[model samples]
Target: MTRRRPPVTPDQIIAHRRAHVISQAAKVGVSAACRAAGVSRTAYYRWVKAAARYGSAALVPKRRRPPVMPTAMSAQEVSAILAVAVAHPTLGARQLLRHLAKHDVHRSASGVQKVLVRHQLGRRAQRLAALASLTAADTGQLTDAAMAGPFGFCQAASVAGQNVSMDTFYVGKLKGVGTIWQFTAVDVATRWAIVALIVGDKTAAGAARFLDHVRAEFGRLGVPVTGVLTDNGPEFVGRDFTSHLGDLGIAHHRIPPRSPNHNAVCERFQGTLLHEFYRPFFYRARIDRIADLQTGLAAAITDYNHHRPNNGAYMAGRTPRQLLNEKRPAQSAA
Candidate 1:
């Protein structure tokens, strides 16, 4: 035998009907609102029974239970972890674990990974695929020009006693008002460099001034410049540059156009200058004062030639100055 459900009163039926009408009008619908209100149609009917037995208080809902505690890490700890990750984004989980260990945080790599995943901070697996798609493919073989030569072509051909290569770099932005150019000359075999900062357009006059500086250095060393090899820039090929070289009785050879490899010695030294001195000096002390910058450049060049090792030559154990001094005996012998 089955028990029968209690009868619903008129007041409860009216309240439930009113709720259903309002819910459907609000777009929540009767079914959704009942679910949200934690009441079934049967329960609504039971409330009607209560209303029949009692009054309007039967329509009221029961109190809801409190929410459960979250398993997520604290905000402070997450902030610290994020700060560390940002400072060294390239660090792997093992490295990160080691770094954290030093700071007294003992957590497994897998545990850290779980935390990262929970916070939506895990490295994307598709990032590597995207990187691969973006990278350029390595083409075929290198030509003779592209290949690194034995002792490099510049060093191999340039006898320590003779050849020099000259080049120029713009030191200032030409905002129409003015500009400065740095003209540099490097002894191909010895790695000795003479740099000059000239305030003006990179004209023939600027090149001539640089030549004069090189001439003065040659006088001190008591060595005559036999040949000067330079790129086919306007300043080097101009009448003033040619006439000055002619007066000094130095043979000038213009490198084949677009072939910097022929003058690789000077190019390599320029890279060293930019890396070891120019970049650091410019960063620490802004080159706003031209005179100070020039003085600093000169000192840098002196230090480079006298102290820096020359690894390109047979005299690898010696500095540029020491190699040049050694070259004097070889030149005298010749």
Candidate 2:
């Protein structure tokens, strides 16, 4: 009858390894130790290799096959994506691909994201680095490295009544609906946000009305906004919008020409809306009217403020509603 080699438990193998190594240390060599332990020199050496590589956990069985399957993206493509990602950490993959396309380099968004994630250079990492730099500058560091990005290192609201930004954007060209305008407001401190659909052409009156809506919505949630920031677009600079802010006793600040970084939080939120809400909500479903789109926007924003993680510097990993609840006294004061 053929005898099977008895199963060697990880603990037994580990004990055997200690004996073998001890023998080697005593100038007895691994061979004598292997013989005494009923293990071959090959098994002894394999154990030695594994122990060196993985420490105590090496006694457990490991895969003999290849560790990781190769990715679909080529090494060259991944390198390019990573290089650009480190250079422009704020940009999304789709935007990154566009920048690469000019140089005849191409990569899918997921593949590019994989490269960024692998290197720990994802957007969140970038945000943290930027925030650190900003804090340093705020404490009078004044070095170029401290004041690098245009965002000026957007930190969360130190006080509950810090800056909030508002903006209007053109969503897309729907078949029968023409262009849909989306008005967005985001609290820089708390990452609390709200969205509303605008009908007809965008005007100063519409902008002002949207500001009022934002105030009421934020107020109801106990997050009274103190200051509002907007771009230098005609709708925002016109009398209607400024007058509306003056009436509300809210300070209004306008960004400089071609400087979106001044309003980076609002712009980033717009990108979030496009990626998380608009693309999936519109492209995947059947919608016939603007009213349907409106409902969809409302639903999306509801999920955003309550369920989604903001990942903002100020948020430090909390949903808007959670942050509000945690700071109820401060919000109530506002």
Q: Which runs of model 2 end up more than 4 angstroms from their true locations?
A: 1-156, 326-334
How many clashes (backbone N, Cα, C below 3 Å) per candidate? 1, 1
**Per-residue accuracy of model 1 over 1-334 as CA lDDT, tens digit each:** 9999889877667677645644453577556756666667565457556766766565555457887656455666566554455445566556677766655566677766666555544564322222222221123122222122211233332344366889987766434436877888888667778888777778887787788878778767876777787889999999999999999888776777788887877787788888887788878954567767778888888888888776754546688888777555345435
TM-scores, all models, native as reference:
0.50, 0.53
Q: After superposition, how far is residue 73 of candidate 2 from its true place, in Å?
A: 39
Give the TM-score (vs. native) of candidate 2. 0.53
All models: lDDT? Answer: 0.66, 0.71
Error of 1 at 299 (Å): 1.8
Give the worst 10-residue stretch by lDDT in candidate 1. 133-142
lDDT of candidate model 1 versus the reference: 0.66
Tell me the deviation in Å of residue 20 in model 1. 49
Q: Which ranges of candidate 1 are over 4 A from the true structure?
A: 1-161, 174-178, 313-315, 329-334
